[model samples]
Target: MSLPTKTRQWILASHPTGLPTYGTRTDTFALETHDLPALSANQILVQTLYLSNDPAQRGWISPPSQIDPKRLYVPPVQLGHAMRARGLGRVLASQNGNFAAGDLVQATLNWVEYAVLDAGDPAAGVRKASELPGGLSVTHYLGALGGTGLTAWYGLVEVVGCRSGERVVVSGAAGATGSMVVQIAKGVVGASYVVGIAGSEEKCRWVESLGADKCLNYKSATFEADLKEACGDGVDVYFDNVGGQILDHMLANMKQHGRIAACGAITSYNGEAVLPMKNYFDVVSMRLQIKGFIVLDFMAKAAETVGKLVGAVQEGKIRVGEENETVVQTAFEEIPGTWLRLFEGGNQGKLVTKL
Candidate 1:
């Protein structure tokens, strides 16, 4: 019946020199309390519930990608400003006709408990939570039924155009988006041989559990040899999620006319030295088509894409942490620390926290 006057938020305290540490580091994030402001004519107030912590947040503080920074499509968040995320929340107040109080919605709300959204901005979109179709949890807004699935659907199906019998390889295959790509490639797109590349044996097993023909740990001593052996007929479509070295390896071993969906490049999001790849010209020799895309580019297809994924999940056709039980959950207060787990390969499937 009554709304709080103050809200807690995580703001940019200082720029991170490298990987930001939660709860301890100075340059990571700082939680600050702010008084709620009155809504404008076209704004709505939201009470954030589940927040999605993604690798893209690394690009927020880290420098632009040295290869081609624009693909990240990261909007700028100035210091002392609250961190923004796509959150499954409820509208507590509204000044716009688009949303009403008590409507469950997903928006570019802040990591804070509450935030204001301008539904008209294409980027600052707010979708009704009840509208998203599939789920074992509300965290689906952060994974398969949200931007993650949208990215995988458009990239694998449209960008790579994977065929039924094609040999597909997915790098960064353990992340939220990467994991979805692997499943969609096999279960939905009908790829014949699917290989996943991640950092650890556990991640590899999770990939295998998702019906991947094989999974390779990129950090292994024989990683290069493993990848080479996995691609018996060479990679037909490579869903590149972690770029840089992994991409170079895939490029060097691709089949002729192979397609690549250039998704996120978390490898270079650390603002560190970038490794050089001499094999990029393989694009010319192999006649490869490497296209970089941001999921936001395919927003128009969100409903249809999410609907398909939801149906697949419900029918037991796709595995997205629900069918196989791989979700990792934590408390709302641990949001900052929980994000660090992704970079370290410490998280299992979709790492999310309850509000």
Candidate 2:
């Protein structure tokens, strides 16, 4: 096999002040052709196949001074470096013992078509995608059977400890992780009433199809009243994905000792300060328990969790990419725009780019 001596990459040209925009003259990201370096011992070369566009990408590219000191997962993508991203790829060649040519892997492939990764680097999160259970499309590894699905499972099952016949509410209910929460809360866990909050009526309908009893459009003028009506009794569990006014509403409507799983805050992902909980007193008064978690926190149980998720999907208790995903089959240059769609509410569910 002949390998190219050079590779095209999307480098972080400058820190983004807000949602990143890519164009002919943008500093957020700049495409450059660079010479590929020879792989050292225990290094593997991979050809990127698909990329995941997540809300977390925004936080990963913010100005270093702006990011919260406590929330630093890893150092922000440094200037002039390839923009960090999660992707699925195929091993093109390898000097590593664990991997070989043609092995499908999931890792932090960044915004490049070709990547050279060290086999021993745990930060790369290298795993064999081909080893996942059969009968599922390759994209499901990035959606239902991947980190997205695992986050939903961990938040709902472990953090919130949701139970049968409970009243559950999910914000961003039509999104990737949120949609899965709806399925598990209602269909799998047997929640008696599941209310979903989405951006539009179309999304609301889709959320209902995913087993929500009622899906409210937060953009509506009567959204507050609608939320009050949706929560006839106080909510027992809340799966919160957006943390702004909607969170305040959920806080106000929570039952005494209600549990909340703070999964992601898309409302503030794009260079905005997280909105303060005006109804914070509700937390004290009602004794509401809210815990925030990231998917990495549950790495030890990844395989077990993924097994359950696959079981649910196989039994048709949960729907995956075909019903709840939007794929962009475009070139690498369009990746930033695909990521931008999350903040803009331009996508229905998990957004992935097939390169």
lDDT of 1 by residue, 144-184 (tens): 77877788889999877888989999987877777888888
Q: Give me the candidate number with maximum lDDT.
A: 2
TM-scores of the models, in the order given: 0.90, 0.95
Best by TM-score: 2
In model 1, which regions exceed 4 Å deviation?
22-26, 40-42, 63-72, 95-100, 119-121, 131-135, 321-333
| lDDT (C-alpha, whole model) for all candidates | 0.79, 0.87
Cα shift from native, residue 107, model 1 (Å): 0.8
Q: Poorest 10 consecutive residues of model 1 by lDDT? A: 63-72
lDDT of 2 by residue, 1-355 (tens): 6986788888888878877777544568888888888999988999999998888778888886788645777678888888898899999989989999999999999999899988779989898887545455687788777888999999998988999999999999888888999999987888999999999999999999888999999999999999998997799999999888899989999999999999888898776776677899999999999999889889899999998988887788887757778878877777777777889888787888888
Residue 219 of model 2, lDDT score: 98
RMSD list, candidates in order: 2.7, 1.7
